[model samples]
Target chain A: MDADVEAARPWVAEASPTFITLIDQNHLLSSLYNMVNVPQAVWIDEQGRVVRPTETGGSIDILREFDPEAGAFKPEAMARAGAAKALYMEAVEDWARNGADSRFAYDPDAARQRVSRQTPETMLAHAKFQLGRHLASLGRVVEAEALFTECRELHPDSWNIFRETTEKMDTGIAAGEAFWGKVMGLGEKQYYASIDMDGMP
Target chain B: MTIVLTETSNSECVAAPSTTDLWLDADAVTAATGWTLKPEGFCKDDICVPTPADAENYVADGKVNVASFWRLMDRPAAASKDGDVWFLGEGATERNDALLSLEAPDFTLPDFSGKLHSLTDFRRQRVLLITWASW
Candidate 1:
């Protein structure tokens, strides 16, 4: 459970029950839980049924404390993270008390539908990322670069995809910053775009 | 996505790309790692690979045969020069095995501090696995 929740650190520091944070080095848990985006969560019951699908959780009101316009740090990203956290936290609470009977729990059909909603574009990006990883491992840097570029173009909002692509490209590879930075900038721009589109305050 | 497994008396190996091109399945992996791929996934005692898929066609077609598939992929085979068998192949190479299933393979990964952990460790606990980068 590797997470960057500086906003929640204060709350966690002030909490009562003991809580431990696990750093997921390879995103094994994130992939297992189908957490495609930041602040997404899935609540699985003892029987292994997902009581709550991945949804935005936690409180976004905390963003009110930060200034987005400040240099280096984008406030809109903070706000988006907050909204996602709020939704996820709300779902968690619903599942915690109600168990299987919780209104938040999806029927098998709904769960399947939710899984299917991942969208072909998203799935293709995953494939492209995987293929890039494969090619990179094979020492075919050029081919891997192309695949990763396509992946970024398709999934511009995924920080993980962009980061992994850049890391695989390494520093010695030419056009490293220009190619990778373009995607990083796009992600930031999308973050701001999302806030405006959602009409978030 | 076919998983091809080829076996020899002393060893077995898995190859991929196309099972016809290489043996990339559980049996071959077991030969390489001394573990077996089962329905429950790759297992060596309690630890498992968890990326199990059918490799019948690959095996039957001899795509997993070490020597045959190596030649097909232009990968080198074990060469003995000084009485020590040196297996040669590009390390850190990624292979496309295809989307066998959406199920995530369960395994404990070693962190920077050399600690092994798994998703089950966070069961019944609140966890946030944030995948991000400094860049």
Candidate 2:
């Protein structure tokens, strides 16, 4: 869910997907499902039990080969993210067609166990993020910046955390130098954690 | 006790009035914690958490005892020994408890047109709930 509801609306309006779209200005899903990044997916069954923990869900196939000379992202990075997206979409389709019988669907216990990996630090990070959003909404830039920075430091793996916070402060990916340096440091292959599609039924 | 406002992220520090108790007005509480005191309790957005019965006991001189409010929610906070400045950290007690049950916590939010929608409205339907932001 997007915290910047206003910004997300235009894209939603353009795509006009025939599905329920929701906004999460507080990023509650991040804490609820241990989602560290955007475009992540969580599978739920008809009975309302989560069948899959949050995982990277996106397709970067449309992205032309990463031209390092012309773009900030590396080719290998986009390739890895794309591969994960393809596999994730496949699993999603399997679940859609087969429901609970799908090999890709995890039982309640499995889902819980997978998401249980969230550490106390990560949980705190989530809180810091929500606080940051609240402060930002009130126009408390200095305070919000502190909390957002805390969130990123506490959960370095959560790129969305950094991206969201920095973008709000106008010091993120668009800022060029710092953003590119961090991205380069975190190689493209590791941009989105690789999806775990191996243990499917 | 003097409340020293220190920036945890960058180690910047500022000192506020020295006092024995950390009394924050309602507006200050909202700005610091994102939760506003409502008739239902401390609320943020569409979700409301009931304020503890002992909440009133913490109020004195028409200011809220932030430390006590934190205690009521079973959250932790740190304050300078002098009590002039306090830094409230993020509290996840409620969020963690809700997540432990694996049942989606219900909330309401307004759409682009300011129309409100609740999560429970879609009960029993296979929902592919997706969250995205412009950034």
Candidate number with greatest DockQ: 2
Pick by TM-score: which candidate is best? Answer: 2
Per-residue alpha-carbon lDDT of model 1 for A1-201, expressed as tens digits?
Answer: 322234334443465324334344333333334444444445455544444444433423332233436633366656566666565555557666776676666666565455423333444455445444444554667866886788778666554555545543443222355543553454324321221112233
Clash number for candidate 1:
24
lDDT per residue for candidate 2 within A78-147, as digits (tens), equals 6666676677667777888888888888776776766645666776677567656655665777877887
Scored against the true structure, residue A164 in model 1 reaches a CA lDDT of 49
Q: Cα deviation in Å at residue B55, candidate 1? A: 14
RMSD in order of candidates: 10.8, 8.1
Off by over 4 Å in 1: A1-20, A28-34, A57-91, A101-103, A116-147, A153-157, A166-201, B1-20, B23-107, B110-113, B120-135
Supply DockQ values for each candidate.
0.09, 0.20
Task: Provide interface RMSD per model, one decimal.
Answer: 10.4, 5.1
Error of 1 at A139 (Å): 9.5
Docking class of 2: incorrect
